[model samples]
Target: MAFECVSRTDVGLRRKVNEDSLLVRTERGLWAVADGMGGHEAGDVASAKVTEALMRLPVVYGLDSMIESAIVALQRVNQELIALAKGNAQRTIGSTVVGLGIMNGRYSCFWAGDSRAYRLRGDQLIQLTRDHSLVQDLVSAGMLDPAEAESHPNANIITRAVGVAEELKVDTVGGDVMPGDQFLLASDGLTRLVEAQELASTLSSNGPAEAADRLIETVLARGAPDNVSIIIAKAT
Candidate 1:
């Protein structure tokens, strides 16, 4: 199997600290990104804790095992964070997950909440994970148009997150991994500022490391409203 060329994370312009975490397993060619929710520092704790849990999962496995393991790990972190919040009383914490793990030349990804994964091949870019957010639900029900939903006052109100619920049902995507394929695993910060085509352009122009930098620069230039984390990798 070919390697995943690059993976990285950066704090965006507006946030005090990066509440995002990422991991890359060279052995399995896997990559992941998490966007944290909650205030009062709990968000950072939640994302870091969950990412550490996920990193423990074995790299050798089918997509199902990886996906299920991630869910279970996130569930455990959810319980831990909930317990921590009860003690603090002044804080509540949650996190969104988006990840990619590859095996036998196929890539599988899973997500919770709005953090997203995108696949860019040739001239097209496809978003693999759906956002588990109130606005997305409304869009699906045709209760709101996509453009209006983007700017809605409650647009940031996520309906589901990894550490918010007792159990997390992470959504999944599995597909072919062509040699030239480019994958993007990102926190909501980058997507909220840059569109799919723009992302595709960035991926096509540079290597994963440079692409990651460009992605952050784009968000910062646009005045990132939230903490951003980005991972851009290419099939070798």
Candidate 2:
């Protein structure tokens, strides 16, 4: 199967620079979104490192091999970022990553931090990756309500991220791919402003490019405060 892909990134209304990075290699069936966290310490560099690492990954034959290669590549990038941070007096520089890889008739979703992967199968939209943020932990532990988690003071405090530690742990999930399956990978900037229902509605009504355009437009309409990045892919 071939994929129709579209990706976009914006600095938004408040941020001075865009720290988000994206990768879309249609030939390799690899797509990713990375949202960098450091402000003056070059968050954009951290995100760019992630995409660069992914770009170096060898094209494998099977879904499982591809997933393994992706994990290794991300780990290497994490180490490189750690070394970069050490050279700069250890100021934290990191990024949240969410990636999708397809091979044969299957797809793999992998992530760290709050960047998300959502799959739209037919009329149903499903969030394929779970967030690794403090608010998410609280919500999962039943210590906070789902609706209130968004407004929680620590909502932006992510529990895990690439390049933040000596060893990175990535979460991976896979499933059989079907014709007409639509996948979205996005940073928190877009999700913070657009509701899931709105996303579902917009994606369902348009093709990949239009869907990506509309999503970014929606964020801009809400006076986006952070860098927004998104990638949309449809199997054909």
Candidate 3:
């Protein structure tokens, strides 16, 4: 099996700096998206650090080994970020991460924070990772309605992130890969503007590269308020 992938990132209309980072190692079947927190200091540094760590992950032979290596790399990055933050008492930096790894006809989806992974199969779009955000928690607890969660003031407040604490918790899900399956890993910037249905349609109609471009264009048309990053992959 082989994968075709494409990625794109934009600073957006309002943000002065693009604090989003991504990795697209198609040869290694590894892809990731990191979105730096807007109010944090050195947000770009945090995101870039995580991506750099991921890029250095040793070549593992199996799915299990790859997953383990990914976890270890994230933990190492988290520790480094914590130490860096402690050195400066006035500010802190953190980023949300979402990644996809494919090996031996199987795939793994892992994440921390609101960045997400989605799967498109046979005209249906399904979200693979849940958000670790305040609004998500509220919605899950029935404190807020799903339709109202997006407009909530605290919607952007993620409950968990890479480099936000001494120890980082990563959520991972794995499954068998299918032919014609399309996977999308994106930062909140794109999700905040494009609906799932629209994403599905655009992805279904275009190739990986074109789909990525269209997605970015859609967000920009909506007055992108934050940095946007995305990775689109198709399995064959």
Candidate 3 lDDT, 1-236, residue by residue in tens:
88888889999999999999998899999999999888998889999998999999998799889888988999999888888888987356899999999988899998999999999987899999999999999999999999998899998899899988788999999898899999999999999889899999998999889999999999999999999999999997
* Cα lDDT, model 3, residue 28: 92
Candidate number with the higher TM-score (1 or 2): 2
Candidate 2: which stretches are off by over 4 Å? Answer: 38-40
- Which candidate should be chosen as best, given lDDT against the real structure? 3
- The per-prediction CA RMSD against the true structure, in angstroms, equals 1.7, 1.0, 0.9
Model 2 pairs whose backbones collide: none
lDDT of 1 by residue, 24-119 (tens): 776666678878883545688788887898888765467777777777877888789878877888456878888888877788888888999999
184-232 per-residue lDDT for model 2 (tens digits): 9999999878878899999999998989998999899889989999998
TM-score of 1: 0.93
lDDT of 1 at 88: 83
Q: Give me the overall lDDT of model 3.
A: 0.92
List per-prediction Cα lDDT, in the order shown. Answer: 0.80, 0.90, 0.92
Stretch of 10 with least lDDT, candidate 1: 1-10
Error of 3 at 218 (Å): 0.7
User: Which 10 successive residues of model 2 have the least lDDT summed?
Assistant: 37-46
lDDT of 3 at 41: 86
